[model samples]
Target: MGTWSARPFGNDSAADWAYELDEASDWGVVSDALRVAAEAVPSDLDSDDAVTAIAAAEVVARGLGRVPESAGSVDAFVARVSAPPPEMVALAVSALAVAASAEGELADLWEGDPEWLAENEKLRSALTTE
Candidate 1:
């Protein structure tokens, strides 16, 4: 991924018919946007679908640099990300938390997640399958 800068969002995150993401000035709006955007998406960060949400939040947060470390070091990464504009941080955290919630996987499964996002786990395995 190219850094998660303040650069405009891509087709992956904001669809052609979706509402304008930046126009969201509060939680209700943000939640609405994410709901519309992630409607069919089965999972988060572990899923490209989820990463798309994280990236959308990053566009608003302007903390794209954290992408490199989000996986390797979550605490340091969240701390750095927590320092951004409040609206940005809150939105980012909300989106990420929702992403995590959607999948129900706190960390790597290292195996199948039969109860949570089995589809996401399947996709993840497919991504690195040998």
Candidate 2:
């Protein structure tokens, strides 16, 4: 099996991504991430993001397909989209976990991070229902 890093997409730090240069510095990927953040998407007809964070997840998953193997790099994708769905946030988490699991990185990220791991676990559990 291949060795993977313990990095949840949003868990990425500064050095994890410095390739974009222009957007990588100012936006720092976080802003781009917010583009698909659960709290960022609009839920209502007026494009209201105040409804639920899950809304962002919906869009994220729809557009990004599945979370890539590196959650750290999601910001790169998020930066491009001006507005993403609410469920995208959840999509981000699920896809990132799938990516991690495939790459063997999930074990590392879940280690010692009970809260984060717990959230991931919950997301994993929810998959069965979906």
Highest TM-score, which number?
Answer: 1
Residue 116 accuracy (lDDT) in model 2: 53
Off by over 4 Å in 1: 1-48, 63-85, 102-130
**TM-scores for every candidate against the unseen true structure:** 0.30, 0.28
Query: What C-alpha lDDT does candidate 2 achieve relative to the native structure?
Result: 0.35
Q: Write the per-residue lDDT of candidate 1 for residues 1-103, one digit (tens) a residue.
A: 3323221232344332124433433334334444433453334334434445544454333332432322222223334333334554455455555554544
lDDT by residue (9-105, candidate 2, tens digit) is 2322322332332344232243243343322212211111111122223224433444333233345545555544444344455443433242333
Model 1: ten consecutive residues of lowest lDDT: 66-75
lDDT of each: 0.38, 0.35
Best by lDDT: 1
Query: Distance from true position, residue 59, model 1, in Å?
Result: 1.5
Q: Residue 105 error for model 1, in Å?
A: 8.2
For every model shown, the clashing-pair count is 2, 22
